[model samples]
Target: MMQSQHPPSNYQNNQQNLDDFDEVWVPNPLGQTQGPAATSGLIDIIKSGSLDSLLTNPWLVSIFVATIISVLIGAIATILAGQRSTELTPEQEAQQALLQKSQNLEQTDNNFREYLTRDDNNSGMVSNPGLLQAATLEAGARYRNRIIASLNNPQNPAYNQHEELINYNSEIEALKRINLGASGKEAQLKYVDPSTGLWVTIPIDSAELAASGLTKLNIISNSRRETTQRFDLVTVAQNIRKILSEVKAARLEALRVKGLSPVASELEKTDWFGNKASPSEAEISDYQQYKPEPIPANPNTSKQTQDKPSPKPTGGQDDK
Candidate 1:
């Protein structure tokens, strides 16, 4: 090969001989020498409108920065989404279900509390036996049909965990069986005729009923108070309140199993149990002091007891 005797001026600055060169040398922006392949790639970038605008145009620089930032943000968001979409373990699922059941029980208890504490007479006590009985039946139905039934449902993870609910169910059922007349319509009176061994229902405002002594009949019909094992609204309410405490404790335990704490709003509410004792003297007075209103006199009514002929049991046969 024929070699050049004189080197180029650029090679002279670097003190290099032309005979040592394998290819022409080119300087990049970073002051580094590049091969033909690198030079070609740089030209491609320039032709693509990247190198010049990215380095000189402020708008282009801003757009480039924004693109890089958006890419990083999207990557981070994908990672977070993967974590959030992770499924709960079987144990976690059980704990979550139990917690939900207990919370529902607690809410029912709160509703019962509101109904039990209602005082229509405004005398600081619920001095209306009729209203009181209605409240008790309502609370019992809620606990049995709604609360206990839900807890004992086969689909519930915590099913069969609360056996006490079954006992309550029995107690309410017994009360319902014994106190049939108490839940009758306010406009009617219900009584079982001993002579005919049948139930007789009569309108409260009927002159025939007034003649039959409706007030006395009501007292005799609602004689469940004399039973040895009778249901009391105040007592039931107090028991339900205690049940709320147990439910809260159970929920707290479920949270602990899941390695979580009760939220700030519930910390205080679940921290302590509430009154579990018998209803107060005031509460007892609510029912004990009840006075039945006197029925108006019917002049045509007979002083003698009129035995109603029984055909079949009537009145609120529904019982509930």
Candidate 2:
């Protein structure tokens, strides 16, 4: 017997087995005794360590973070670029302004044409009531001045007693019929106050004055009588017509030069007078409702109305 240091029977056998197992010590590479191995594969080391003990590799984290940052930056840049592209630049703004001006001119021209045709029931050849009045007053003053000058000039046949005087008196009488302001004593009393016994002037409305002026001119133009000197009056009227045509043509040219063709064209074609020849209610309504197109450059491509002087009215009642 081996001195029986071990327990008898199977107990001794079990102890010997335990001792053999204990003597066989296996080496652990990750254990404290071996210290830490050079961490080569980061994934493997992380998998082996405790949840909290695992090292946070900045490089790996940075890769994912950088990708996200790049994506965000790209998104912001795209939005800014889109915004920049859609915005109107200064050149575009200028073009738009020119276009608008052309349109306005066209509308104005259309209205003028309509007034000239006398299509609207209103008189004085102006679509704008206020403007018509002003024009009337201006014409009245001009005619008065011309008459006075002719009378004062000794060289003028109408200075003392001539056909011109008779014509002038007739024109004056016609103007008085279409008077914009009160006539005779009423007009003079405007500046005087009867209630206060003081000199109080009542200011005339600008629109009213303008209408008066235009009315005077219209009357004078319509009241021309055929006389031996009718040709002279015809020449004067023709000159005035030429001046008006020149002004209109210049305005159209300006619009065209500015590249506002559409507007200018609209203005050129516009008829200021509604259908005066046909007095249908529907036609009148249509004229009132009509809105002219914007002005385009070169509104009138066609030749202007014949500039030929009108034939003088027969003098002395044709002596037939």
Candidate 3:
């Protein structure tokens, strides 16, 4: 062979072998010149791009605009939901007010009952059991007046109004009706006339009774007297028996010593003078408790109204 341009065997043994990769220039495989490769990631492209390039980039701009819009929509939804949760419906508001009104009415009623039964507060006042409606109305008025007085003062604490106070005037006027009785219901009384076999309505006054020549005890009525704060059946029975015994004794004394100074004094010396006619404590003195009898009324009556406004003592008067 001609003189070879290869290394000698001794030189090849001394030198290192060439690497698998080698740098070299060659013609393009497709016969076209190569251009610079895509040299940037998305972040690098955005940073290096001009404003015109950015404006023309629809995908990038669309993503940014969509993110902003989503955030704004979410914020508005959160605010609307918060407002909807905080607001009360009309029915719910009405129910809350009604509950408050009931509570106020109950409190007002309790206050009235407490004042009516307080012994020390009303020393000389006479509370009639037959006219409890009138008493309750009076008590309500007193309570309202007290509240009003405190409200007028600058030093008053926080106060809330009750339905009882608002309609107090109207309630009192209604309670003044003659037939409105102890139970706060219409309770008219009637009696059967023995001679004529006819039913008659109960008369109110002592004058009316005298004019009709009818004694209350003799005429059996169709109404029942309910027990009140002042009621004591035992005490009433005791008083009735005591008065009857005294009257009999006085009559005897009057007959025995007519126009004598010692007539009244003679009855004081008697053995049964001070006590009722019940058996002594040593004997079987326990008497069974008696409930008041119900006297039924016939529907027909003569007079529906009473001459008097109410039966007895009350706390206060009408509205301004």
What is the overall TM-score of model 1 with all chains considered together? 0.24
Clashing pairs in 3: none
lDDT of each: 0.48, 0.48, 0.44
lDDT of 1 at 90: 88
lDDT of 1 by residue, 147-190 (tens): 45657689975476664555445455544433443444224555
Off by over 4 Å in 3: 1-202, 206-231, 255-320
Taking the tens digit of each residue's C-alpha lDDT, what string does model 2 give over 245-307? 444655776678687777766656543332223212212111112233322222122123223
Q: Model 1, stretches more than 4 Å misplaced?
A: 1-70, 73-75, 78-82, 121-320
For each candidate in turn, the TM-score is: 0.24, 0.23, 0.20
Per-residue lDDT, model 2, residue 307, is 33
Candidate 1 local Cα displacement, residue 208, angstroms: 39
